[model samples]
Target: MRVVIAKCSVDYAGRLNAHLPLATRLLMLKGDGSVLIHSDGGSYKPLNWMSPPCSVSDVEVEQDQADAGITEIWKVVHHKTADMLVINIHEIFSDASHELGVDPGLIKDGVEAHLQKLLAEHIETLGEGYQLVRREYFTAIGPVDILARDENGGHVAVELKRRGDIDGVEQLTRYLELMNRDPLLAPVQGVFAAQEIKPQARTLAEDRGIRCVVLDYDALRGMADHNALF
Candidate 1:
């Protein structure tokens, strides 16, 4: 089995559904951390059908069969071989940051630094030796923003959104659901960090025992800067 990773501009699930043939099986890993697998009936044609099928002028029936076989094989190979695969929007671009007119590496660096600072500050508040789990991939869900172990022996999952959009809460709820199912993550508390949160959403989170923190750009920047100085 061979694994191939392709960069796709569209959503991974949509791309796979369009490209994968009916006979091939497909497994989709979503950015919001959802997993789905599809199985198609096996093909009727055999391999090595590339030769001319009898008296055809400029058209080979064998070639058509071979093409179909190859296409199905490619899909099967891609699905079976990959243990875990991510199809993030960021991976679509050759120079993603540059495509967005920003330095990709710098942006990543800044985000990592900011995350580290946020983790440190919050861990201290929770008490000592809290470690940050970076790029932790969850089953069904791809990667969460941050996963941390609190000093008091609790798990913490944080999601960061730039805007104060209520729609974003749906994704966080999915993450929380996954965490609740995992034995290792059951002790986890979910936190939503965004610039602003809708009043209804805040109320909903509070009712559900989730923590929502709203921080403006300047406030977040100040926290990062403060963490750096200390």
Candidate 2:
């Protein structure tokens, strides 16, 4: 990964047009060929970012651009979408690179771990014909909580959370993206399961064609009646 602190202006073309005026910002050139531009604030989110499967190259600056204090230009073009992110650099304050080895991935808490086990034992909770493939099914990115197959033999990836949020939805989406790339799991579906799901999380999950399932912890544990009204 390479990090650069520079005074630059940004322009994005394709799908939409956006411009960021000249300012001092942090530019990240990731190992996966993604580029991100970030300001001093906004927490973890970059002000603008281009995801992986893209190429970045140094491009020549126009005479007028050079006259306006631009020293260099970096062009990022998406491989699939053809979206382009242009960075006009006036000055680079700092530039550095780091070699980050393979990530171990996030560890789930005790409750989530237990929930995964319960769901695996009762995979049919997802649907009548669902059968568990395995728990913690490993992928290049991370492990999905549960991998199952529907009645029609379609692959399904389940992401479990104690309280479902947008982040959880996004995580599952990444897992699904990677899993579906494999010929074996070309059509893997996603199930976001939690004890309680937030409205925003449900909306996003459904929008992405991922199913949302609310788990009854006690019932799954066989401690509560399934037919109880209260």
Candidate 3:
């Protein structure tokens, strides 16, 4: 995803970039006074840009304008491509808060704790001998969300996504490669767990001796009923 900052002051550019996802590609257009963001299947057009003392909503309006305009134009430019935009007004607000000397680390910590709790609870229920291991660590290709272990002493790596067209098969392949490298982890198997699994990914897993497990909100609720160790 490309995060386009238009007409932004030099002082704010670095601050804005810091809040973006590390994987996001950043583009800066100084003195243009407009912001445009482009991502999978959508684009955000140039919108209003104003300095501090502006209400959060006003800043969001500018972002929305950029998103709307850019997305429409992107669709026209590349009809075959998917151009999508996700505007987070709070991100700008957070930057402002940081500039004002407010510590946002507490809020971030709270959010992380909450998510970790959810993951721990669900993973614990996966079976009798499973445990939550590392999280957001790099494997062979990139960072994986979670790496778990079964009681039988097998390793399992898992990727979590709220939404997206991910290549789970290739992703799992990389995890398997990394796991096999570790003498202790070589005996473990790899599993791809998502809200939904693509057919191609499933086929790829089967061919490579990996397992693909789909788990949604509802599925998670009943996941413990099955004996995973067997």
Candidate 4:
């Protein structure tokens, strides 16, 4: 990763138009060829970013640009989408690079953990004859949200998310890949369950032969009979 602190202005155009006026900002150039421009604040989100699968090239600045205090230009172009991002740089302050290595991964936040427990208690909500093998089943990569067996006795690996996004599906896919390697859990299936799932996520899950289940937190509780929650 390379980090550069410089006086720069950014312009992005594609789905929308955005501009960042001349200011000192932190620019990040990732090993994957992606670039991000960040301000001093705003948590972890950058002011502007070009995601991976893009190319970044240093374009020569015109004489007029140099006269206007612009010394360099960086142009980033997306491969598949053809999106573009241009940064006009005036002066450099600091530049450095470091190898951070692979991340350990993220953890569940908010009420997501509690929701997983509730789902385990009401495993039947998944479907008739669905039995919970265990919750937080251990795996080499990490814990699988819940491991179970469907009515047909096939191994079912489930991943629960508060808001199911593409990342949830990706996580489940990785788990399924690892579990299917075990002879005992061969032919494992995946199910993505969440309170709310994005349409794009559902489509991606379907494309990968994974099933999606939209969950109901309120339905986890019952009045007369506990099984009625299913």
Per-residue CA lDDT of model 2 for 20-54, tens digit only, reads 99999999998867788899986555677776678
- The model with the greater lDDT, 2 or 3, is 2
| Candidate maximizing lDDT | 2
Q: Order the candidates by TM-score, highest first — what do you get?
A: 2, 4, 1, 3
lDDT of 4: 0.85
> In candidate 4, what residue range of length 10 has the lowest lDDT sum?
221-230
Give the whole-model CA lDDT for all candidates, comma-separated: 0.47, 0.86, 0.45, 0.85
Can you tell me which runs of candidate 1 are displaced by over 4 Å?
1-131, 135-137, 226-230
lDDT of 1 by residue, 1-230 (tens): 11223332212221123232222223343332233333333232111111111111122234564454321111111232122222222121122111223222323346545653565455443336766765344434334677777666688787676653555566676677656545556767877766668888788777777788765556556766887898
**Candidate 4: tens digits of C-alpha lDDT, residues 87-195:** 9999999999999897665567757887887888888889999999998887645689999999999989999998999988888887786566455687899999999
Would you list the rank order by lDDT, best first? Answer: 2, 4, 1, 3
* Cα shift from native, residue 216, model 4 (Å): 7.7
Query: lDDT score of model 3?
Result: 0.45
